[model samples]
Target: MNNKEPWLAVNLSMLFPGFGQLYSGKALKGYILITIEAALIVSTVALWVQGSLGGFLTGFGGSILLVWNLFDAHSSSRSGNEDSFETSRKAGKDAWLGIFLTRILPGLGHFYMGQAVRGCAVLVLYIAMNYALVLLSGSVAGAILGLAASIAYLAAACCLLYITEKNPLRYPLLHIKYFIAGMSIVTIITFSGALLVRTYIIQAYTLPTGSMEDTLLTGDHFIMEKLSYNNVDSTDPGRGIGHGDIIVFTPPGTPVQEHVKRCIAVPGDIVSIKNGEVFLNGAKLEEPYAKGETTYSGIEAGRIEGTVPQGKIVVLGDNRRNSLDSRGFGYVPVENVTGRVILLYWNTRQILKMDFSRIGKVR
Candidate 1:
């Protein structure tokens, strides 16, 4: 008769779908549930990356499945049925230890369970997945690949839990030593991968001021795509910064601070501001996004007359009166440009709630 703890079964499923069923000796049912969960996760992620509204709604379905899995696991454990995986449990294999080791690194739990071949395969697959994630980061393909890798890793852990010898009290202290070693390796690889992705692929930033009002607001959290700005080609406007694009960069005088502004004029363009209206190449420039007035006094007036120097661009904030942009600090070198703002994912204006409507493409 099954003598498993219901609480333990619930907790196992909490870690990942189907885990609790495996713990309850329902191996076939657990595997099927895991496969279903994986498919749901992957499809949801793929749809979200493609900017589909259905993906957002599908996420709620996944959450509902988790609740059902938890309930099923608890009920199965409480039924007192015969344990199907009794042989492994009687052999003194600690399922919890296997789960813990796999949490540290996908294949470590398999090694602990004496499945060396499967363990090696899991490790190799993990390494390859991470390498691919780094290469494809900041793109639609990257998002889908990252989700697939995560699902695969979790599935591998569930597999370990299913086959691992149970009864934690029988194992020696040697398992702890292996866990520590695996954790150290995983930590190094994880941090290095995150650093590479953040540095060369994408990075998150929060707007600190209403400089780009209406377009970007204070407390709006957004992601910037660094790949497009890396090794930019000045001659090809399509590959680099261009007129009307919102960019994050270090203002000319503020080397330590970053600012977000709209590129008003590019190199070789004659720029002049007459009574707050901008003129580019002797023609009136239309700016529907810009607000506020530009004062003709002091340094602001001096910026009114100039041909954008080579390798530099003129930038101005949408909220012109409140911003200290190229008008006050002069031209910004192209090298100071960091990245283009792509997605605004969150807003922190309300301390207790998020403004979901504010989340969308930066444009």
Candidate 2:
């Protein structure tokens, strides 16, 4: 074999980005030791500059270039010493395989080939980045950041391929380890965040109709707190839906139609509708939001003179005539009640002075 050209490697590495140093047997140069390491920096800068997924163009370009540079350096450094390199290169087939897998699944490629530690780190970073994108600001800029950061992975894969070809016997096991570690970390984080979001934060729901007109208009976007009524333990399931709660529930008969209405009477409460007015416990319940003092004039369907069953609540809309509420379908059971509406955020065009009063506490 010819004597290794250490001087040539150094010159090339120093002259052409990562080449000269790598050719000089400085493995760190072509191995993403600097460029790959700078991935986090690029990501941070991109986020800081663009601020969201929409502004990721700068960072995306930088990332792709960075990855391309790394690959070029690796290729150029291996150009000389063809025979000696050829012998070393044959063992790298498995490493190339690892790199190939990394392209599609990030750290999984490495883990599949058995590089557990590196694969775990990559997987952790990947999951964290994706979580941040989903939770904070889901603009197109975040998408670009994700795309740009992916280039480092490509560089890592390229290097891994070369390394594996140099030592095929050891590459397969390392790749597999990386794949498993990456998958494990990703699975854990994904489910963890899902549980957290589902448990604590409010969810956005769209209101279709104007049953509760002047209060919750149609095309309104509102948020409902999930844990506000989840306090019912196994000891007492009846403690969920209380009186005065604006609940969303499906009536007993037509289970498919979900309606949102104010709960006026709980189980055993005496409810009476006289002259289109609601009476609870023999006293006239004053509704300030009702359009007028009128009874169900033509419709003889919903008026009731009965007691609320156990675990049921009588619900009615503020718009007495236009609404088809519990008066029509009967009372709603506590089990079908999902949660209470805490806020109202109607569409701007649907209501005037919307910007000034778009959001308000729900009745």
Candidate 3:
């Protein structure tokens, strides 16, 4: 009796690319779909990281596959024709369910497959590994750690899928109580991970104003890496903030808002403006990227500046005449800095008129 529900198959496929096919008794097709989806995803991610336009286009294929999978699962369920290669479902263990859960979180699939102790251990290890990687970000070591973590996650997922398919365990993973518990766990872990990544790894922000002008225009979307100045001595010019570096930080009076500006002078450097030209340590600073005419309107206007106080930095926007930076808000404390802008990945000026050339590293 083919008692499969079409909606149920569609829902399973929605959870993970081949899960619906597996539920509809097309295991061979399901496996093939999963492999193709995985390959597309990995390739897309890698290419995107390298700032390739092809990566952006490659994402369309994944979307197409997802839609097709959903439709196929629904049709297969409605037809009630089980493939000869379909494995017996008499065993309570579901390889598709295990793989889907693992896709959500590494150890979750093991728990669904009746390996409770192993799951718990793997869960703890996965959390610890992620924490360590976050701590190590922004260096060669961090890159290596991230790669190793990816490999480890892939290996664990593969092992869980294989074991669940071969073991035929009587785990009641589909029970309402267990399913709810699993979902709840996944929710908590996912939220925590997102928060951790945003706080310590990287974050995306859009420029709402043209304070940066030629360097960064209004409606430009860029990614800032939080790891560069994290836990490092800001006074050290070699390793910390340096001249001409663009940074994002909370202004002195504005705790709720962030401003992006170029670092003009670090601690111990004297800064002043003569006429409309900036002088750093008694020498006229040459700024080729600066836009518009400079005017003496900020708080530091016409003031004979002394050495920048320790743990402080002088910042100014590329659009000198239009910016409200350290000149208007005073020297920004090192602690207020959130991150350094690394790339301008997108422009939200208009949906149909996006400038693809702007998608590159920020100087």
How does model 3 score by TM-score?
0.59
| lDDT digits (tens) for residues 275-301 of candidate 2 | 778888999888877655536556565
List the candidates ranked by lDDT, beginning with the highest: 1, 3, 2
What are the per-residue Cα lDDT tens digits for candidate 3 across 112-216? 889888888878888988998767754467666766666676566556545654432322335323333443454455456655666786677789888999989
Q: CA lDDT of each candidate?
A: 0.73, 0.59, 0.72
Model 3: weakest 10-residue lDDT segment is: 167-176
| Candidates 1 and 2, the one with greater TM-score | 1
TM-score between candidate 2 and the true structure: 0.48
Error of 2 at 141 (Å): 29
Q: Which regions of candidate 2 are displaced past 4 Å?
A: 1-188, 195-201, 233-238, 297-303, 345-354
- Indicate which candidate wins on lDDT: 1
Estimate, for each residue in 323-343, the C-alpha lDDT of model 1 and write its tens digit: 878878888888898887777
Better of 2 and 3 by TM-score: 3
TM-score of each: 0.59, 0.48, 0.59
